[model samples]
Target: MARIKPQALLQQSKKKKGPTRISVTTIILCNLVVVLIVFFLFSTYRHWSQRSRFQTDNQFSASEDGNAFMDAKKADVPGYAVLNTSKGFVTVELFKESSPEVVDEFIDLCQKGHFKGVLFNRVIKHYVIQAGTAQGLGATEDWTLRGKHYNQLDMSLNLKHEAFMLGTSKGKRNDKGFELFITTAPIPNLNEQLIVFGQVVKGEEVVQEIEEVDTDENYRPKSSIGIINVSLRQKI
Candidate 1:
């Protein structure tokens, strides 16, 4: 039998040792990548959970139905509008400073009884109750106002959709529109979508009642809920 030389033994050892180092490094890198992936997943889940919690807490607070009255808050409110509906009265404090033209147009419409027979056609649970459109909830109306651009109507007001806030947005044409919506909860999702021209300074409970009313699958009230009329109060 031939005896193996020392150099050959050393070369064989080198091959085995070289592969071991490479394998060890690859395993370490793979494990590190897995750790990073898990950490990222955990962080994303935590962020989502926190946001959901915040949304729930804020919604609860907004729905508490706190003191609803035309008090000091309405002192410098510029104006107010009382909407007489089938359910009850909903008084809104107009945001004339932020949205002048839209506010004025709304006031004009209210005083002229434009919404006299319009129904509260749409009501989304925990969302908004929409009205003020001549063609009911779906069809687009040709309500021409002073300004044609969206900014003049305060469509860029970017007001957070809080409970009782009255807002309007365009239909398919996509500009400052006449259809108005009364929100029943704080909706952050609608932040930059609609123009909030006023907020309910009074009759919050009335809004709650309207929102709690039964509706069809299409969110239309099972029972007729019409806007008897809207009265504008320049001095709140």
Candidate 2:
């Protein structure tokens, strides 16, 4: 029992003890904060990555003719359609940039044998040849990939209806259906009045041959010329 002053006792009482042990609550709270932070960062990164990846896609430049086109440097998603007809096989280049959903629907239909044995119901000499029923009357039963004209893009990109152009038949303004057509000559009257989604890159002579086929007053080919089959593939 050494004599100690009250001030000394107070100082000793104020001395540091052993290190404080972290409680379970503190540990859990710290871990939860770390997890939340990681989750936020991860979500942000995924969003940025997706946006960056598709930013260049579906972009286009306006041409002098008011036609929309993806720059030459930018890669094009062109589809090559090899139409096997009674006359002959014709190759076409469908531009996805002009009409994305329409082109996709067309490709889907072709893959599912949509046009197999389908007649070119309407054929006009030196003008155009047409197929697919109005409003796609008999094209149902898994044939409709989407709603009727749900992806309506009329005269998309102001695509000109030039010679050998492929387009959808219109019943009314912006009311086009599966009825497709190919021009044997430049149908300037139909320019901006129809959606020009594709062009015959090769076998123009074949299309011309079909145009010259025998047709009645209603422009229906008398000899029953139509598509035997249609094959599609990727192009540059």
TM-score of each: 0.53, 0.53
Estimate every model's Cα lDDT from 0 to 1: 0.70, 0.68
Clashes of each: 0, 0
Model 1 lDDT tens row, 1-236: 99999999999988774433457889999999999999999999999999999999888776653423434444434488888988888888889879877787776666566788788777665567888543423432211111122113343345455567888864442122367788776665555557778889889998888878787655668998878888877565
Could you tell me the C-alpha RMSD of candidate 1 in Å? Answer: 22.0
lDDT of 2 by residue, 1-236 (tens): 99999999989988959789999999999999999999999999999998876664434322322343344322344468899998888898887777777787777778788888778766654456777656332233312322122224342344345578888744442222466778765554565445777888888998888877776555557888788998877662
Candidates' RMSD to native: 22.0, 17.2
Model 1 weakest lDDT span, ten residues long: 142-151
Q: Using lDDT, give the best candidate's number.
A: 1
Write down the TM-score for model 1: 0.53
